[model samples]
Target: MTSILIADDHGIVREGLKRLLEAESDFEVCAEAADGREVLEQVERTHPDVVVLDVTMPRLGGLETLEHLRAAHPDVKVVLLSVHGEPPVVQSAAALGVHGYVLKNGCATEVVSAVRAVTEGGSYFSPSVARQLVEQLRAPRAEIPDPLGALSGREREVLKLIAEGLSAKEIGQQLSISAKTVEAHRTSLMRKLGVRKATELVRVAVRYGVIEV
Candidate 1:
């Protein structure tokens, strides 16, 4: 059997994925984890051949967790999943030696293919993200811009809404935070992104796909 460990923050998602994998006669799911730390624990215990990890989770992020796994268990393979097709995050995961990148929106078949690819010692990148990587490879590479580092998750959320052209009141309503908090996020993004003007900030956020604008 192709031993597997599935990792995600959502119980429903993990349960669904587990059932899907179990249906495949060639695959065997050995463990499940709901966070990065639990991922490490599962890996240590199960030593599964493949790890399917979600990108976003509380505490240590998926990519960071993968790095830790590579250090301690180089024999195991990993396939990363994400909703965001952001270039920087994808690139960083690739550099960390993830065997595959599968978007959660993809069909279950794609997930299986990703796992098989990694198991066979080949890497996989989801179609959309792979295309982006190809374009970037053709272009001149620049120093990685960690412009979003200082911004908290809440701040990032606000910046994305702002970039999507949502008014502060609308964003505040959506996030359940006050309008004052929304403004504070904008100010934090401005400082972290080093933008002097609202237009400039929006432009930067849009370019990064942090917001829809």
Candidate 2:
């Protein structure tokens, strides 16, 4: 049997995943945690074979929690799950030696497969995630240069604050700049980034590792 741990901030989500995992004859949920801190605590105690982790948890969050777990329990497999397949998170988790990654919507389709694959010492990434990774790898390496890299220091600062979810006024106050100036920088950054709106900016920010989703 494969001993597993389910870690997600939402109680309902965790319970749902637990039920699904438990339904499999060879899989069992040995532990469950509502957040990253609890995940660490439970894993140390249970020593589960696989960890199904959520990326947006409170405290340490999934990536950082996985970092700790990898150092402390190298034998355990890690499968990162999230609602959004942010490129930076996916790429960073890949670099950190994660066994697999699955999006929340893909949970029904990919979670079990990811768990089984990772437990068997193989890598698993959902089809959508695979497509996103390919896009990310190609986006920065494509015929065109990364426009964000062309940003001036002040423009980059503006984008960071925007990605942090700060209002124009708030960012201006933080940087001791006029709100109009902040807006102008936002416009410039969006144009350079080829993103039409704030939401797309956040998407780009996530891709570039400028912000966590």
Candidate 3:
């Protein structure tokens, strides 16, 4: 049987996917995780053949988790399920060597097909996602300005916390940095995002998918 690990923050979504994948005759639901940290932990413990991971989660996020997975378990296959089908997002996942890219809104059967294809040394993408990749390839290689590309990793953390309504002091405590340093990050974020007000920073964060609505 093909062992699989499912990772998503929503219990209902995980359960639904678990049931759907288990119905496949050659598939086995080996494990489940609620967040990216748990995903790494479960992957280490279960050593699943394939990982069905959601792009957004409480900690570490899908793309970040995929980075760690690639370094630690390069042989394992990852099939990302995301709400975003934008060219930048799909291109980012592809650049990271993701085996499959399936939209959350796509047909459920697509998920099954993705897993099967990847296991057989092929790749898969949702029809819309495939079209986006094709269009990107057909277009000139001019650099598409990524909104989040300007921010450093620390700035991204500060942006997320700010969007979540955390004060500078609170964010500093969580990141183990001084409140003054956090303030500096906030200033840099506003500058890079081209916003003057703190409220504008939150809007920019949302626009860049630094935080969900």
Candidate 4:
């Protein structure tokens, strides 16, 4: 049997994914995590063969967790799921050695195929993601720009939460940081992005694929 760990911030999404994957006879969901931090913890405890990770979780995002997973558990496979199929995001996951990339809007069967493909020492990419990757490879190396590249991972997390309309205190609670720190990240994000208002921040976040609309 293939042990799987599903991670997503939304409990409903997690449950849905769990039920979908568990329907497969050979797949067993060993654990579930609400955020990237919990993902890491569950990974250590459950030692799943494959992890179905959502890209936009709170605290440590999927990319950050992928880095840690590659360092600590290179043998495990990862299939990244995201609503955004931006080139930079797909490229970043590719660079980090993700085994599969499945868009959230894709058919549920794609997720199962992704897990199976990765476990068999192969890779899979949703058709849209594959097209973006091909475009990326054919274009100039500097053709695509990632605005979120400038911000630290923590700052990106803060920006995402802010764009989601969470207060500084709420962001702090989720990240386990102080409200002051969240404010500091907000200020930094605004300054770095050359925006003067929170609304501008939201616009920038949406435009740059930091958060989905």
Candidate 5:
């Protein structure tokens, strides 16, 4: 049997995935986790053959978790699940040695196929994701500016939160920083992006595909 671990912050998502995977005779839902910490704990306890991991979660993010898993549990295959199909995010996951990349909107069969392919020492990318990658590769290289590249990691985080409509206080609370620090990051983001207003900042983020619309 191919023992599987499902890691997603949403309880409903976990339950649905467990049910779907368990329905397959060769696949077993060995464990489920609500976040990255629980995912590591479950991996230690259950040692599942594959893990279906969500890219965004409450605690440690999926890419960071994947890095840890690659270093500590290289034997296990991982299929990243995400809502964002942005090239940068997908490329980062691919560079991290992810075995599969499946979008959240993909059909159940895609997820199953991803798991099966990864466990069999192959790789899979959702159809849309594959197309996007190919399109990027085929597009002519241009000296297009990268606004995100100028921002620090923390600045990027603040920008994403701001784009999501989170206030400085809320972003600080979520990131464990003070509101003042959040404000500082927000100001720095605006300066770096050369945006005079918050709305303009969000527009730049959306244009660069930093945050989904």
Candidate 6:
């Protein structure tokens, strides 16, 4: 049996996916998580063969969760389910070693097929996602600076908190750092991102998927 974990913030979505997968004799719904942190916890406990993870979640987003999973649970296959079919989002998931990219609006069968293919050491993409990727490849590529790469880990964390609308003191308390230090990091973040204001910083973070809209 292919034990699977379904991770999505919406309980209804999770329920629907579970019911759909349970209809197949070879698939078992071993676990379900409402957020990225819960997803990691469930993965550790259940050791599911495959995970159907949504893109946006509380605590941690799907892309960040995928990165952590890659480092810690390399054997587990991941099929990313998202509402987004944008090139940057799809390309980022692909770069993170996602086994499949299935748009949420695609037919339910596509999700099942993605899980099966990934479990079998192959890969899958929703038709629309595949077409976008293909078009991206066929188009003329331009060299673009990756602002995300310029950010350090702590800087990214600060950026996320800022995007979440936390004040410097609140961010410091959450991170166990002094408020002054938080301010320093904020300054550095602005400098690194080439933004002069907090609003611009938030915009960059959102654009790069550091925080959801």
Check candidate 1 and list the clashing pairs.
none
Writing each residue's lDDT as its tens digit, candidate 3 over 119-153 gives 99999999998988887788777756456656555
- Candidate 1 residues 1-213, lDDT tens each? 899999998999999888888888999999999988799998999899999998765444676678888889999999998786887667767767888999878787888888888888898888998997787678766654556544555665676667667898988997788999888878877888888876687787656544332
lDDT of 5 at 105: 86
> How do the residues 1-213 of candidate 6 rate in per-residue lDDT, one tens digit apiece?
999999999999999999999999999999999988899999999999999999867666787788889989999999999987766667778778899999888899999999999989999999888887787677766643456656555676777888999999999987789999999999999898889987899888778667667
Best by lDDT: 4
Best by TM-score: 3
lDDT of 1 at 1: 82
Model 5's alpha-carbon lDDT is: 0.82
What C-alpha lDDT, on a 0 to 100 scale, does residue 145 get in candidate 1?
51
lDDT of 4: 0.87
State residue 112's C-alpha deviation in candidate 5, in Å: 0.6
Question: Which stretches of candidate 6 lie above 4 Å from their native place?
Answer: 138-158, 173-194, 207-213
Query: 210, model 5: CA deviation in Å?
Result: 7.9
Model 5 regions more than 4 Å off: 140-213
Error of 1 at 203 (Å): 13
Q: Residue 77: error of model 1 in Å?
A: 0.7
Model 2 regions more than 4 Å off:
135-213
* C-alpha lDDT values of all predictions: 0.79, 0.80, 0.85, 0.87, 0.82, 0.86
Task: Please state every model's RMSD to the true fold in angstroms.
Answer: 6.9, 7.4, 2.4, 2.8, 3.8, 2.6
Ranked by TM-score from best down, the candidates are 3, 6, 4, 5, 1, 2
> lDDT score, residue 211, model 1?
36
Worst 10 residues of 1 by lDDT: 204-213
Candidate 3 or 4, higher TM-score? 3
Score residue 99 of candidate 3 by CA lDDT.
98
Q: Model 1 has how many clashing residue pairs?
A: 0
lDDT of 6: 0.86
